[model samples]
Target: MSLDALTFRPATLADTDAVVALVESAYRGDSGRRGWTTESDLLDGRRTGADEIHAVLAKPQNMILLAELDDGSGPRLLACAHIAIEDGAGYFGMFSVDPGLQNGGIGKRVLAQAERVVREQWQTPTMRMTVINVREELIQYYVRRGYLRTGRFKPFPYGDARFGLPKRDDLSFEVLEKSL
Candidate 1:
């Protein structure tokens, strides 16, 4: 499907499973390896879970944005991202695009829509995210999208199985931000 054919909508509780699957396929395991955004080499196990997504959905200031394409068939969940109002800025995370459809410009659209959701809907002035510092390619992708590296860092949770099991010891996150 063309980029114009994609649909953007806020995810509800009913969309939990599809959202989790889409995220896992894009970031972890063998499924994630099919996509350039995969962090399979850096981490292992689940990318996200129902409880976490449910928490995000339950919050009044947070939402999971889904990007779908209805190509004669029923709508297919192609991509998704988590947006939350942290302090005064929009925090973006849990971004995922179907591994099979990566590099097809779907991710770019989802990100743009996410920024719009925060800027227009929430009246937020800035968008921010944390990226695994080792993922240079992924970091560069966001840089090209206008995100600036803040030089600030957050230590990756080593004991948090919910995030993932790190394959290396030097894992950490770098902050990135953009004005809306």
Candidate 2:
């Protein structure tokens, strides 16, 4: 779909199911394989669940930003990302775009809106996100969008079913930050 037909809005509890499905399609299992953003090779099982989405919605200063497209057939969820202000910086996570729409500039648009919201609404000077350290290509994609690698790392939540099952022992997260 064209970018002009897209709409950005804060996700509500009613959108939990669609958001979960969109995230799963972009990151886990066979369905995610259709997209370049799939993490299927590095992880297994579900990427996210309805309960987690519900928790995000119920929290203060947190929101799941959604991108919807109306192509005359009716509005359909296309992409989403979770954003929250914490420790004086905006945190971005749970990002996903429709597999069929990957590399078509939809993700970039969603990211721009997320950054705008953090900057304008939260009045934050910086935005931060963590990417799996092994995802060099994904990191490079963010680099092109002005995010810088901080060389800081965090251990992956091994044994945490909520995050996903790690396929390798070396899995870890590298923090990336950008000045807004």
lDDT of 2: 0.94
Per-prediction TM-score: 0.98, 0.98
Off by over 4 Å in 1: none
Write model 1 residue lDDT over 5-113, tens digit each, in one string: 8999999999999999899999988889999989999889788999999999999989999999998879999999999899789999999999999999998999999
Which ten contiguous residues of candidate 1 have the minimum total lDDT? Answer: 1-10
Q: What clash pairs does model 2 have?
A: none
Candidate 1 colliding pairs: none
Write candidate 2's Cα lDDT for 53-150 as tens digits.
99999998899999999988888999999999988899999999999889898999999999999999988989999999999999999999999999
Question: In model 2, which runs have C-alpha deviations exceeding 4 angstroms?
Answer: none
The clash numbers for all candidates, in the given order, read 0, 0
RMSD list, candidates in order:
0.7, 0.7
